[model samples]
Target: MPNIPRNALRSLTLLVIWEMWKERNARVFRQYGRPATEIVDSIKGEALLWIKAGDTALANLLVRE
Candidate 1:
């Protein structure tokens, strides 16, 4: 595999974490003002739809059982 620079990898990881944090905040503070269940459900539904639309890899990963 090709080598990725440390800074680049760190930046990518930070971006992902920031995105997750933002989603959590939106779900907990803005939309439902409670636990993240609703937000998680929405993400699941979106993932399922995306899988049905041909993203087999993501769909497989998201499926629970």
Candidate 2:
């Protein structure tokens, strides 16, 4: 696989983390009034669902292991 620059990877990681944080904060602030722990749990659950969906798609493709 091609290499990624350390700084570029770090920046991308930070951007993803920030986006997730903002999304959780917005959802809690607007509708749920939930605590930080609960908000993080919700984000985790959502991410799990996304992973499951992707896994399902790849399985359907039957790509070589």
Candidate 3:
């Protein structure tokens, strides 16, 4: 990896895992599925929420020039 800050990496990892778990639950319980692009978009949106909710590390990583 290339100079990833620890907290941002941890937050991103947990977010991805959580999103995957959610997708799994949706598929298993509700028979719902989304495309990979939708999932990636969801991740991006959720990351913004995380930043707004006080994840400075993620904000730092995401808010780039």
Off by over 4 Å in 2: 32-65
Residue by residue across 1-65, what tens digits does model 3's lDDT show?
58889998899999999999999999999999999999999999999899999999889988752
Give me candidate 3's TM-score against the actual structure: 0.92
lDDT by candidate, in order shown: 0.55, 0.53, 0.92
lDDT tens digits, residue span 8-45, model 2: 34543554586577776878887645677865676555
Query: What local lDDT does model 1 show for residue 57?
Result: 52
Model 2's alpha-carbon lDDT is 0.53
Structural similarity to truth (TM-score) of each candidate? 0.44, 0.44, 0.92
Could you tell which candidate, 2 or 3, scores higher by TM-score? 3
> Which of 1 and 3 is the better model by lDDT?
3
Provide the lowest-lDDT 10-residue window in model 2. Answer: 56-65
Which lDDT value does model 2 have at 11? 42
lDDT, model 1: 0.55
Report the Cα lDDT for residue 62, model 1.
41
lDDT agreement of model 3 with the native = 0.92
The sequence of per-residue lDDT tens digits that candidate 1 reaches over residues 1-65 is: 14544543454344446556768787788883545686566555655565677765554444524
Off by over 4 Å in 1: 32-65
